[model samples]
Structure formats: structure tokens, C-alpha cells
Target chain A: MFFIGWLVIIKNQKGKSWIKLVESKEIIEIFFHGRGGQTAITASQLLAEMAYEKGFIDTIAIPIIGAERRGAPIMAFTKISEKKQIRTYDSVKEPDYMIIFDTSLLDIPRIKDTIKEGVIIIANSPIPIDTTDFPDNVKIYIVDATGICIKREFMHSSGPILNIPMLGAFGKVTGYYDLEIMEKVLKKEFGEKKVEKNMIVATDAYESVKEV
Target chain B: MSKARKDFTQEQETKIIKGNVSAAYAAKSARVQVIGAYPITPQTTVVEKLSEFVDSGSMPGTQYIKVESEHSAMASMVGASMTGTRTFTATSGQGLFYMNEMLHWATGTRLPIVTAIASRGPAPPWNIWADFTDVISQRDTGWMCSFCATHQEIYDEILMSYKVCEDYEILLPKFVAYGGFILSHTSKPVIIEDQEAVDNYLPPLPDEKGWPHIFMDPERPMMFGNLIMPSGFYSEFRLKIHDAHMKAKEKIKNAAKEFEKSFGRNYGNGLTQQYKMNDAEVGMLIYGDLALQMEEAVDLVREEGYKVGMVKLRYFRPFPVEDIINIAKSVKVLGVMDRATAFGSPTGGPVSSEVKTAIEGVEKTAKILPMIGGLGGREVTLEQQTEQLKILIKMNETGDAPGDLFHGTLWHGKLEVE
Candidate 1:
């Protein structure tokens, strides 16, 4: 809901910092909704890292930590700014983008209420979601993040490790960070050993994501 | 058998980290000799990260002891500090309350043990969230207390705390507190300064001779903190503690200045930092996480034609009396906000009470407004803060107060329970 119009200093393929003034540096707040064990918390952090890696001046990852159990609803938010320092630890009220890790969470009243006007939704569902009651200008993108994870056997003890693929799909939709940045961030966070498997699901979700 | 220690080559890098992790990294950067750890929410990650660093040999030769309770944690740090080593510990809420007895002991014994408090609301209703009452209640403990409004400040202030606390003149323990969950759990980009730079900024570890006041050599026997009679010099020692704190104000300022010079991050004059206070009619004094959020509120309201400003109270113990007086003189109405409770106090908030005391009898100062909000992790949104600013401006204009004032103090954002 805030405006952040500024330049982005991303590194070129030649390994030099290339400062490019973004024409539409539209401000974006990413609201992440998922159940516990779905890795939505990690997804928010990964998104912030990818954005910062691709040269956003300020970023904050806020996970609403409270009585979280394996199947209970969990929420997080990532605020990315190019021109201004992102202050305020408060959760995003009107999100420009909502990354829904579980499609069923859409049925929850609180989650449904958050799908405000002019918002773009990136949902992890194999099929299109019902957007009949959504506010005007609400755009929905679909990616089979769990399917990709299951096909690649990329999962933790609880369930699918969906954050990587979801973020990959996010990169495709938003053009914030590409697979190269994702690979680099993944390598840094999970170390080199786990990067290969992570990128498998990540590349799948990135290529297969489509607007609905 | 001690395993071969890995040679750590710590390079400065800017990474997104939580406030607790920043504290841990600061302790590592300062090369603390001893760490006594007891896990509690919010503050748990601090010692957890340090333990990881010690285990990985990144913090080589650091003695990390896992104690049973928060009391023993402080007790062990006190014992470790007696040996003239730089000691560190962390706790929150009840964990801090349990260390009350030893907290007084740490200050009384004149040990420079620095502890980080991820401030949380004291529980009867079982709350583990951001509140300053945990550290503010330790007021009479004689230990210096500071608040960090940002994650990076957690790192910077911990390093500065050591410099000020370990000074030969001010050998007093201190607490560096930040809002739990709000600052503690949230992630932000914090620059972990180069080890060499941190080493240069902090005081060198104490020599084998120990502190000048007390020596623990078997040949030179000495007794400390024994029973003192009514005529004993206990009162004088207490007075000296007060003197040391008053003297530390200058040292804290110098340390902040030097830190800014070395690291390129400025934290006001070390005690309080004001934003857009010059040529302002109304101002808000805030601390912890709320202070940073209030800045955005100030900006939003400013764009809408209100000339409001804010001052962040960085240090609470040495009260920043002069800074408070100067700020009061600059504005017509100064609103002091607290994220902590002082149940029976005149203003119903800790910092508000102190601000009143600081500016008492000061001619032509601003009228005081005490406010308490965001306790127990309740969100203080930008919208609400903006509204608060408008209220302050109205107060300055017509001496009007918010209708929600509970006994002359604004209790903002209390939901209807019925």
C-alpha cells in the first residue's frame, strides 16, 4: 500500500553491479498465508533475501509467531522498498500481493477478508481458485508447488518444502528475482549440498507458473 | 580433551538477521570471554546463536555455560566476571525477574557484566511479548539500562555497553533491552562489523590484577559484600554507584560518538535522539520498537500539514535528564509513550514518570502527556500513531486531550472486551 519508486542496482551476468533506474518502482507488500508445516514462514524470509539480493534497499520479514501447531494457520509478511527504508513492524493490512501456500486457506474467513482490491494473488494450487467474490482488479496466478515438490521428492518430515517453488513462481510473476538469484540465495541459506534438489522444484514452479 | 580450535576469520557482511541474533553477533564481535546462557522466548536466540558460534569455534576460547535457571545464569556471569573477564548473558520477562537479586549483586560488586533483555510483559495472564516493564522494573538495581529501536542498534549498543560498563571509572553492569518479537523476532539487514573494528572500539580485557577496587589473590586475602553494620560504608558505596551512573552519561556519549565515527551509524548523543524536532510545536518521546514506527507516523502527518516531531529515548537508567529538558523546551506539548506499565505511578507509565521528574521546576517547558500502548505484542499501526500525532497537535492548539484518557494518561488501542 506504500509507494517505493527508486533505482535497482542488480549485478549483471558479467559480475558487475549494474544500477538501473526502475521505471515502475511500484511499492509492494507481500502477505504470506499458510498453515504450519507448510514452510510459509521460510518462504517469506526467502522472498526478502531474494529481493535484497536483487537490490532492494530495505526489506523486513515479519512472521506472526503465536501458538503455531502442525496444522494451524500461520501468517507472515515481507515489506520490500527500493527508495525508502522499510520501517514499522506491524503486519501488512492491505497487501499488493498475497502468496497463498495452501489453497484451502482461502476458505478461512480471515484470509478471504485480506484479498482486497487491486491485489495480485500467487496461489500454490494445481487448479484455478474461485475469485467470484474478490475485489476488482484482483489478479490470481497458479503454480503446482506441492505437486512439483512431490514429483521431485523434495519434502521435509512434515510435508512438502513448498517455499522454494512458491518463491520461484513469485519470481516469474513479479520479475523481482530470477532463478539465478534464487539459486544463489538457496546456496547461501541451505548450503551447497541442498541447492541442487531445491533448484529442481524451484525451476519447475518458475517455468510452469501461469496467470489465471 | 579440548578439540583443535578453528581459526575464525570473521569478515564484515550485511545480512538480514533478527535482533537477538544481532546481540549474539555483537557478543562474538566483542570477543566476550564468558557467557552464561538460560533460554527464554525472545532472548533465547541470542544465547543459542552464541552457543552455535562457540561450538563451531567461530568464537574461539569463549567459555559458554548452560545454567539451570535464569538466577544461576546471572549468578554464573557474576562469578565469571569476578575473575576479571568480559562476561555476557541474556533473558526476558520472568527470566529477568528471577535475576533481580543477582542483578543488584552485579552492580554492587562492580562487575562489568553486560546482559541483553528482550523486554516482555510480566505474566499473570501468560503473555510473552514486547513490553519494557521487564527492564524498567530493574530501576533501583543500580545497573545502567538502554533501549534499541532497531535491530542494528542491538548490535551497536551491546558493543557500546561494554565500552561504557567496563570503563575503569564506571565498573557497573548494564542491560541492553529491545522489544520482544517486534524487534527480537523480526528480521532486518544488520551489518556485522569487522572484528578488528569491534576490537578497536571495545576496551581491552581486564588484566590478571583484576579490578582496582578488589583483588582475589590468596596471598592478599579480601572479603566482599559481607554483612555491613548500620555505621558501615554501605551508604557511601550506594552513593558512589549513583555517581558512577551520572559520570557514565558523558562516557556513554563519547562511546556513541566514537562508534558512529568507526561504523558510520549515528545513535543521537547516546542517550536520546530526536527526529525533526527543530521548529516543531509538538513532539513525541518514544523508545524500543515503537520509536522507529513513530518516525514514519511523524513523516505521514508532516506531509498532511502538522509540524510534529519525535525523540527516541535510548538510555533509561541515566534518565537523559538534560536531553529531556532540552526537548521539552523545544516543543509546546511533549507526549511520552511507554510500552510498559507502572500500575500505581502518577502517570501510569515508567518513562512518563521519569520525564515528568526530569523537567520538574524547569521554567517554560512543554506540558507533559503520558501514553502507554502496544503492550503484550499489540500492534501500534502507523494509522494509529498518525492519529495520536493529530491529537498531540490539537492539544498544542487548544489544550484538548484525547477522550480515552484514563486518569490523565492515554491508554491507546484497548479493545472492548464486553
Candidate 2:
């Protein structure tokens, strides 16, 4: 009877194999929470472009548009798929990954609630964060992206451009992309003059990012 | 007006680009000679990209006119078209609404000028998200309207738009619209075809003689849009425009066939494309970006032992009536989804109302479920779409409609009010 029950379980799993494959090969949806002018929205687009350049079959970067101010909260979503086309254009509700460009965004209830079980987070912070409030299934990684940007002198008129470093840390943790792919896409997007400096900060963040 | 054709041996390149940029690339590839520009959200980047191309001398000899308003943009396109050049421009939402006056002027003059529209919701509170009402509202403007579901289709359809619109037998302005931000802002890999192959496919730019009817030549200047008496061919001109639109249905199909032969890409009859509909008992008719996602929903629902299919309505003005009738006959129940509002119209949604009219006199047809969602860029997730499919199946099985049917239409995804 135990063997028959085991067989039944296996049969059910077999019947639902397509769902499993879909989940496995599913588009990786990543949510970004940041302050305006921190470049989180651009990060979302850069990540998609980099993933596509790295040979992912499809990618879409969506920015949630609203009234904008210099330091107001902003949100964006990037989805990258390996084989199947990413069709739905909805904002990611249950993201596989999250990038917090400003760790203070975690204090906002709406941003905090976006955190769910089984999500890997790569946050830009100079110090470790208190993850006790998060579910146990969630993993947290941190990189001093802002510090790296300062160190590498990657800044615009407002402040440090955080997208490259955040993307760098993301690449290091998830292995979705790498420094090489980063250089290639950045050079193409930002042109040759800025690529070297951008890669400097990106490389620093990639090497220094660590689990919290 | 035949010129020496360029070589066609160069390979096509695929680039990860936004839908707006894809439209710009299509205009560049089609070698559009005149570009009228006005900045609007989502659509601004399209003209920006073109201006850059022109500034860099990549599009040599092309004239870029920076217009102050969308009205002037369309007016400039009409003026340029009268001068015998391939003309193109793009606009969205309020910009499209502003151009309403000139839209009639282009089609009335029978100029084959092509325009891309990044469709957005009309506003009282204001919105910049994906909605189709802005384009659908122009249905009576005598222009051929089509929607694209993917980035590559945005490029391919514009190329095909010029091919169909420029045909002497069907000289009509066409609007190739896609959902704002949903398509306009999203990035995807799209193949930019070889220019030589495109040139070979599209008709050569008209010579100085201009279109068959009108031209702006110093040697023999002609007048256009002059007043005509009520008894003097005014009614006849209107009838001819109607006649050309009816005839364009065939020209569009032939253009799609020839495009496929040259580019090796198929767009399912150029009117409507179907997915898994051969033995479907329940189906949905959708267009624009939503149609692509609906395919995924159909796939998921089919996995659960349900017979579901999807038909993507490509051309709106040429209203794929025969295709809708045929699909209606195949399904027990059909859901027509629209992302645009029709206010107090028969169905409260644009495409659904059209679907009802198309199947009105059919001998055997599915019961139509008029549905609306994703207005103003409301996120219609795949799960919601799966539920939508299940609702269709339930309606088929139980012979009952879904709840929240306002005036016999299901307004899905409404927020609860306390």
C-alpha cells in the first residue's frame, strides 16, 4: 500500500510536470525599490538589456510611473527569460529577486510588504541590515554600492549613479550576468568614454558583495 | 519612377530596443523622406531617435520638420506627402487627440502617409499608460487602423503599412498603434531587416509628379482640399473613400503574403492570427499587447484539459469581420476583450461592440462575452487571464455569464470601494 501511494504521488507529479518546467524555465522577475535620481529605473532597463546581450531569449523592463521628485520612492520591474517569450506586461507581485537601491526603502510599509518568501534580495548598503522581520526562506545579500560609486567617482549632477553597482552586486549573487556582460552592455549603452569608469565601480561591487 | 535597386546581400541585425525605437527604425528602413515631429510621452523617443538619425547623416537627404503641435505634425505630413515624398510621424494620447482635425485631411486627400501611435488613456485625471481608446476614437477619420502585439511586429507592420497604403488601388493613410508603455516602454529583441530587401518590397517613392491626383510643382501647380459644392462630387468622394477602404482589405492580405515571401516571417493572413483554435470550443478575441499574453493564457488553460484558443485581431479599421464570423462559428462561447472604453455604446467597449456587430447576421455563432480590463495600464497578470479563460469555459458549461456584468458586459479587474 505504501508503494502504491508513492506511485500515486509520482504519477501526480508527472501529470503536473509542465507546471514544474514552466516554473523552472520561467522568466526571472526582479523588483527594484529606490529613491528617484538613484537610477533604479535605469538599472531595471540596463539589467534587461544586459541579460538580453548575455543571450537570454527575451527580456522586458517596466517602470511604474508616477509623480516624480528628487528623493521620492520609485519602483521598477525587470523580467528575463531563457527560452520562452515573456508575454505578460504586469508589474511583478511575487518577484524571484529584489534590488533595494536605498536600504531605507525597507522602512516603507508598501516596499516592505513586497518582500515575500523564497525571494533573494541584493541591497545597496554600507552596513549589514536587520533581516529578523523577513521570512526565513528569504536570503539577503549586501554591497556598498554607493560607497563603491563614490570610490570609483561615478556620479552625475545629483549624486552617485547607483544602477551599475547594484546591477554588479545582483550579477555576483544570482549569476544571471557578470562583469564581462556588464562591460559589453555598458559600453554599448553609455559609450566608450564612460565604460571604463562604470566598469570600475561595477567590478568593485561585484567583488565586495556578500551575504548578510 | 524606378531607380537603381540597392544590393540585398547584407544580413539583418537584431537589437534589443523599445517599441517606439522599433517604429523609428522602421521609418528609417522604409527610407521615409519627410518626418514631422512633436514631443509626447512614450512617443517622444520615437521622433528623438529619428532626429538623431537625421542629425548624424545616417538618413541622408531626409527632411526632419520640428512641428510645434501634433496638429502641425499631421499638417506637415500632408504637405510633404503632396510634394511626392514618403512621410511618417508618431503621436500618443493627447497628441493624437489634438491631431484629430488633420487626420481627416490626410485621408480625405488620399495620401498614403503612415503614422505610428503609441496608444494611451484619455484623461480627466490624466493618464500615460496603455489604453486603446485614443486610436479607436479615430475610427471615423477614414484612416486604416491596425494594432501590433510585439516589438518586431511594430517594425514589420510599419513596413507593410507603407506597402499597402501606397498602392494606387488603396491610397489611404494608416495608423499602426501599439499600447503605450506596455509596448512603447518595454524592451525586446527585434530584427531590423536589410534596407535593400525593404526597398525592393516597398514601392519606390513617387517622382516630382506626386500622387495620381495632386502635386506641388512650379511647372503645373495644382490645388487640393478646395471647396466642392454639395452636388459636385462631394458625396461621390466620400463613397470612393469607403470603396477604397473596402478594397484595402484585399491589398492588406496581399501585402502580408508578399512580405512573408520576402522576409520569411508570417503574420497569419494580416487580418487576424489564431492560436490553438482548430478544435476550440471556447475562445477569446484580443488585440494589441494583450493578445500576445492571451496566447500564454490559452496555453496554460489548454494544459488543464480545456479546449481554449485565441484569435488576435490585427487590423481594426478593416475590422476582420469575416475572420470574427468564422471564429465565432468554431467556438461555443467567445470572449471579446478590449482595453478601451466606449462609454454608453452597445457594449461599453470598442472592439467588443465591433465583434457583436460583425457576428450579428451570422447563421451560427458563439455567444459573445464583452469584457474589458487593463485600462490605463492596469496590470492584467497571467493568472487573471487564466481565470478569464476559466470564466469562458464556465460560461460554456453552465450557460451563465460571469458576475459584475454592467449592461451585459463583464468589467474585470475593478478595484473595490469601501
Best by DockQ: 2
List the lowest-lDDT window of 10 residues for candidate 2 chain A: A1-10
* lDDT (tens digit, per residue) of candidate 1 on A124-156: 999999887788999999999989999999989
lDDT of all the models against the reference?
0.88, 0.88
* Consecutive 10-residue window with the lowest summed lDDT within model 1 chain A: A7-16
Considering only the true interface residues, what is the Cα RMSD of candidate 1 after superposition?
12.1
Backbone clash pairs for candidate 1 read none
- What are the runs in model 1 whose C-alpha is more than 4 Å off? A1-26, B1-7, B214-221
Q: Among these predicted structures, which one has the highest lDDT?
A: 1
What TM-score does each model's chain B reach against the true chain B? 0.97, 0.97
Writing each residue's lDDT as its tens digit, candidate 1 over B1-418 gives 0231224456899888888999999998888889999999989999999999999878877899999999999999988887777899999999999999999999999998999999988998888999999899999999999999998999999999999998889999999999998889888899999877777787566565647455355666678788988899989989999999999999999999999999999999999998999978999999998999999889877866789999999999888899999999999999999999988998999999989988999999998889989988788887678767877898998987766689999888777668
Clash count, one per candidate: 0, 0
What would the per-residue lDDT of candidate 2 be over residues A150-177, giving only the tens digit for each residue? 8878899999999999999999888878
> Candidate 1 at residue B85, lDDT?
79
TM-score of 2: 0.94
